[model samples]
Target: MAATGTYTETFVELIRRASAELPAEVAEALRTGREAEQRGGLASIALNTILENVDLAREASAPICQDTGTPVVWVHHPTGVSTRAVKADFEAAVREATARTYLRPNAVNTLTGANTGDGSGRGIPFMHFEEWDEPRIEVRMILKGGGSENVGAQYKLPDGKLGAGRDLDGVRRAVLDAVVQAQGKGCAPGVLGVCIGGDRVSAFEASKRQLLRPLADTNPMPELAALEERILREGNELGIGPMGFGGSTTLLGVKIGVLDRLPACYFVTISYMCWAARKAGVSIGEGGELTWLS
Candidate 1:
């Protein structure tokens, strides 16, 4: 379970790429959303500024957003690999990335009210490890900002207030309600990752996991796919256009995931991601070769 210098450096590069560059599919979605907005409208202007910022960040090899957000990492590795070693290397890389200015020092001490200057705290860079049959190590990361994270919502089904039941319709209602509540606050023109069924904690985890999917991917389940489309269509129709400016481009994409729930609990969770939506992945071969995956 020893960390190698090469692995640590490669992880640093991975963090750099994820922090500085927006994924192509997400950028394309933003472009398409911009084009759909009225020419001289606020939505168009906001998207235009966003696109320019994306380009500037890439060109300068800098963090995409001022609040670099929390680095949430998922590691998939071969059975023989050591998860503890991987986590140690990842933590090292996160600190180095922070020092290099690719990430801001956002981690703070709750009781002391002090900033963890190196982005290392109790659970600053959250990591999850999974062992697979693959011979190589695959690391994927997403930088989730506090603003969007604050807007994430979880709802229990059979709620009388929203009239949501333990069904797909209920899920839809909950999602729309989240969007309405988050109008322009989660840095609008955002993406929604939803989980239909699970316990409270697992449902939120599954919802955030859905955000790792590509923006252009279609859900394997037909019903979920249709619901995704419906939410996207109806969300934009609310006139909560880019930054809630009243335009055609409210949401760029919607991803849904489902999990088994207990008989008594039907929880629906929604994770909202801002336009930045920064994520990246890398696969490290046994020979130390690296392959970039977006």
Candidate 2:
């Protein structure tokens, strides 16, 4: 089996689908969040509005959120396909997606403060490519919005301020602090993607990558899975509510990933995703059979 298709078009379709549709897992999470809220409460109303917007966006083929977000793409390719080619096509597709209004012109010149208008700047539309032994190409994408990005947090262990030590309990303390600080500012009833180890930069990267996982998927590691569940429970207890309106549905889910770190540094990085957790993936098999992933 060999690959056959217009790579550029397939890439553009991927972006369009990710931008316009809310994955079903995320939708289900929101449904659960809504049910958790008190009847006729602010959180309930907010969740209802969000659910309605999701439906409207899908039907109209419009972006689920006005921000459209920064495109974080990860490509896992088989032996023969060139990563350079995949990146080139991906960038072109991003530009096309922007021009066609599937994505907003989100990229800008940071120092000069100039908008690129085509969704491509020096480091905008970040991409990572990995070689795999499989016979298919898997492209995972996450459209992370600025508001949620603003709420992302990193913590160093042995911090006396919160009485957090260099352990999982410390990680939990830091994570809860982040949620409290966000206070519905990053769009309440959100999902949290956490990295429990790694250095500053790598921890943040790993945390963002955790957002690629579906909301309903469970972590393979039993300890991490338990921690995720506990965090979800405790964070919601803070009562940040939907949009910070103060309700029972503060967080929809928590996803955690861990990486080994240097002995001296203990870092916990959290990447927050708003209610509109825009993520989608696609796989092109050796026979060029395309599959959409949530």
Candidate 3:
């Protein structure tokens, strides 16, 4: 790969400036989670500690709870910009970030996969890519914690169209299924990342990105927004509550992003975000950048 201009970074440099921003947002969710806990839901003391750790991690430049997940990369390339030489540029950024951040190397070989334990090599950080309109390369990074990733899932619905095929009810079923299946394993109370439309692949991407949005943010689309509200309402009603303690707040936030699906396939993906939600990402373009996120 021929080097042009490279913007290299460590996780430390990606979100540090956003530190002041992440807490208040997460605290709001914490308060809500606690309230639900009071109402016989979200029995998540583990989750409480996780959120506390996020705040502490930001102040300390720590890994934000050891899972230090497989790196998720979102790449936006401008039109006419050929990425022909960007061999795993996304992966490179993640590796560089991991190495610099001193992330605990966790990748291992499947057949002969060695832990190598150096924060490099296969599987440590999973790369998810997107090519969008841009002149310069734009990369976004999220360290997807293992606990949350373990809770990720997708299911097929008949006729694959949003609002037509599975409808909102189907989505609720999937959410509860995910929560019940996790059973305090992935750490709770958790956030729900959902994708209602698109084929299998796009749905998965939507679900993953749902984790990237600020935890308390809202969808602008009216119907989609309504669905988010109802899902949040019912998801809390699950009684899985926090950390499997029978309560009203099993989920922290129900974040969603939808893609219009083709008639042939509809996919509902549930990406679980454990209490830590220890995800940090970067944006470089018109906006300035920072590391050690909120």
Which candidate tops TM-score?
1
What is the Å distance of residue 3 in model 2 from its true position? Answer: 17
- Summarize candidate 1's per-residue lDDT along 1-294 as a digit string, tens digits: 555556788888888898899998888999999888889888899999999999999999999998888888889998888788888888888889899999998899999999989987898789888888989999988999999999999998888999998889888999999999999888888999999888887887788788899998899999999999999999989889888888878788999999998899888899999989988999999887899998
**Ten residues in sequence with the least summed lDDT for candidate 1:** 1-10
Report how far residue 289 has shifted in candidate 2, in Å. Answer: 2.2
Please give each candidate's TM-score.
0.97, 0.96, 0.78
lDDT (CA) per prediction: 0.89, 0.89, 0.63
Predicted structure 1: lDDT: 0.89
Which is superior by TM-score, 1 or 3? 1
lDDT of 3 by residue, 1-294 (tens): 642334543333552322212345656777666754553223555456656766777677666656666656556666654454333444454455457553666676667867765565754445544577654455555556677677788877742343334776767666666677887677667778899878777787678788777866778878777778887777677677667777776777788788888887667888887765645455554443432334
Off by more than 4 A, model 1: 1-4
Error (Å) of candidate 1 at residue 192 is 0.8
Instruction: After superposing candidate 2 on the true structure, give the runs of residues whose Cα lies further than 4 Å from its correct spot.
Output: 1-5
Instruction: Note the residue pairs that clash in candidate 1.
Output: none
lDDT winner between candidates 1 and 3? 1
RMSD of each: 1.2, 2.6, 4.5
